[model samples]
Target chain A: MRYVLFLYAAIAFVVLAAGSIILPDWAMFLFAMALAKGLVCLGIVAMMRGGVVSFGQGLYYCIGAYTATLAANMWGLSDIFLLTLLSSAVCLIVGVIFGPMLATYRGIFFAMLTLALSMVLYGTLSKMSVLGGSDGLNIAPPTFLGWAPEGRDLQTALYIYVVAIVVIAGTLMRIYFDSEQGLITLATRDNELRVEYLGASVRKVMAYNYIFAAVLGGLGGTIAVLALGHVDPEFAFWTTSGEFVFVAILAGYMSVPAVFVAAIILEVVRSFSNLYFPNTWQLSLGIFLLIVIVTLPNGLGSLLSRRKGGKT
Target chain B: MSAGVLEVRDVQKTFGAVTAAKDISVSVPKGAIYSLIGSNGAGKTTFVNMVTGYIKPDSGEINFGSRNIAGLAPRLITRLGIHRSFQIAQLCNELTVEENMLLAGAIHHDERPSFFRHAHSAAARERAMATLERFHIAEHRNRLIPELSGGVKKLLDIAMAMAGETQVMLLDEPTSGVAADEKFPIMDLVIEALRAEGVTVIFVEHDMDIVTRYSERVLAFYDGQIIADDTPDEVLLDEKVQRYVTGGPA
Candidate 1:
């Protein structure tokens, strides 16, 4: 495990060095967004693996973003890092508390229940005048400690991005999938009765996964809000949650890196299409999603596994 | 590991106005293969659900091993060494077989929610593989649950339960829809694997031959009550049990 970490750090150091010299701001932005999106999707992957399809991740993401916003503005906090941690703590608490209810449901109902919760959050947030009501609040330039964050907040964003990508996508999740509880989550999904008799509590497993998803969503949302310098009730809206699910499908559920790659590609496509076609880009996006769904049953991650198996 | 004893005392359950289970009490000791046989709507599933902590009984108390586990969280019961497999295998058809094992593995992996703690250590993977190998389908480790045959999927489903490495297991009709020829081998494998590990199993089934073959004792549920609870041969010979099972003793 330590060796994997060391290797990861070495590779990241090399990439950051390369990015600093070669990539432009736009490319860096894409990378950062992709990484954040991937982490968020990974949480969804965790949830989905347990036979759940949550449409409420947007609520966690928005909570993460606004909690940081609330921390920075209400408390005059200077450390962006601390705010990130603060947001994560909040999401974890909420996830652990409400996750069981979500886990109790299954199939389309599960999806709808998550969407309903997120919408409830959105409705509540939109009504709060203190949260800038409908217009949303301007996010202040977040500084790390006392150091006036260097070179176009993008660099700061990029740094946070790299950290999120490495930690969120690393061997922890890989090893988790190998662990006893991880296997139970799948068992719980496949056969709750079997899991129960085996002396595993499916509820606990599902709750933990849901909480993990919340933490990831919160982390990603907080960073994205800080990057965009604004957050609105829309952060909790179903559409945002829907977007995460859509991204998960595009990347397929299992591939952690594919999710990041897909996120960047989605953003790039949206940006380029908007620039070129203006109005019909959504159509293009829909078509692309359809293609992936039809072509890849397991999504992009299956390809990597299939290749690895073939080589072996 | 704490004696693997399960005690349910005077447990009564009502769904709104309908009585699902009534004054039911049974105790399963460690290292016992207990079989529950009943007709449809006999409350076998309901009884198991209550014990698993999915639903609270209107009355009575349940002691799992030494702990009073009545109406506790299902996951908590699981942590205390109780696991189950549904009648038709309820796996997430979308995930790979290995990934399926993982969802359960993560929680049992540690007490903390550390995503950074790589669960894919040599120890975890080897354990998961060993679990699959125990079920005799380790070769199909990479296949998706939906792609496997009903028998194979059933085996994998049981493998997921084994993933938690629990001592007590609950199965609902472990051989429900398989070819008749496959039933004996499946039960044989399940019984052998679980017994070799010293795991106790309690299952519900309509197959009398299976009960006679694998169970040390037979529990008969009729109208939500255990009308007959005894050694398989004893239960088979009892007049009332004969009436309940075949309308009259042959």
Candidate 2:
């Protein structure tokens, strides 16, 4: 059954990767950006499974973007692969330092603490003119390994790159969601005391989850920076984190694939609503969210799980 | 007495002015079944809590083997082989019966849960099913906790506690919310299962009938202290126990 899921994921990856051949340049960029945001939301979904919602995930996202941009602009590094690895490494270290302390909090306290941490980063970044304070830094087009692709080909390459990362990360996350530690996380959500009495450290499980979320958030930030060609303090802004949380709520905790789907849907909706409604795009998004909440309380993922008669 | 598996000495716990446990001391022999009887707030649950590391005693020693586990965390104590069931059945209501059992198996059967291995691996599933079958709740393995009857929840609670390598099992009101007619059957299943595994059993109960039937020895509590410690018949007939604990004729 696990192998079959992996196979399905591989086939989906192939189909999505093929889209770069037919999609227009603008559409490619939109999809790439959406998938990048989806990675950030995926991290939030991971923490949500452990029964805590992070309101300030932008801390890692901003850290990732800044790390990649500074490496490129300051150190003259241009390899996209190295940039992502460096960003993820920085986020991992930050997560390790903070995950344990955050794991000790729950519910609203956890939410507020995470938000506060990100806001502090926002304040710090806004003041640091060396890394481009409010105006931010623009990223140069990146080279894939040693090959540099530009124009439409560059967009296509990036789209495929984002798809590859999402596929690999999503598959690995699905496996984690089915593992013993994963089950323990679900149990912790229901009754933490029972989990502790059963001899599993609830805090340890939560801290590990937070760290995973941070790395994924960092990866997402790197991808977003690569596609957008800019990095700024706003990456760590509370509103930016709020958007990730919004996607996470829309995706639900049940299905890993649902996260990217929700992100793409959000991007498409925002684009069309802004184009047509212009003045009321936020209103449209608000109404759309209300409808989804009223109809699918567990989010878009539950619909698929309900049909399959099992949790993904 | 056969070597005591759990020894509590001069344990004291106070919540402000009220003393919940006052210099309480008891030695539970290996493989013996002991029952704790007291009114609400008389410290029966408090004793269980202190022993299970849920509450650290204000002052005293809780010796499990030679280790002093008084101030240890609950998970550490549980990992050290002392497990307990709550007065109210604590269960993961969102998960199915088999999933709940599988979680217990994964945590206890393995030193640490693997990140890549499935929680419901064939071996883990088989162990979970065997434990469920031992308690006669195997038929409800796929059912959710809310779907089960009170007695079944009680049974599953004890069954999960026994999933590990336990030397001592503390059951806080094992039959509290169970129906009167179902109490004996649940106790019988629990005691038999624990005994078969050679686990030392200490249960808190208000049901005198259950206490007298299952416990070879009884400790009667009143106002945060043990007033009588003897065979069930002797403890039930004590003057102070009759007045303060059982409310029986003196």
Interface RMSD of each: 6.0, 1.8
Docking class of 1: acceptable
Off by over 4 Å in 1: A1-13, A30-39, A67-76, A90-131, A149-181, A230-238, A306-312, B1-120, B125-244, B247-250
Q: Name the candidate that leads on DockQ.
A: 2
- The per-model DockQ list reads 0.29, 0.74
Deviation in angstroms for A223 in model 1? Answer: 3.3
lDDT of 2 at B214: 97
In candidate 1 the C-alpha lDDT for residue A68 amounts to 91
Q: How do the residues B52-127 of candidate 2 rate in per-residue lDDT, one tens digit apiece?
A: 9889899999999999999899999999999999889999988999999999998997568988988877988999
Candidate 2 chain B minimal-lDDT segment of 10 residues: B241-250
lDDT of 1: 0.76
Candidate 2, residues A71-109, lDDT tens digits: the string is 999898989999999999999999999999999999999
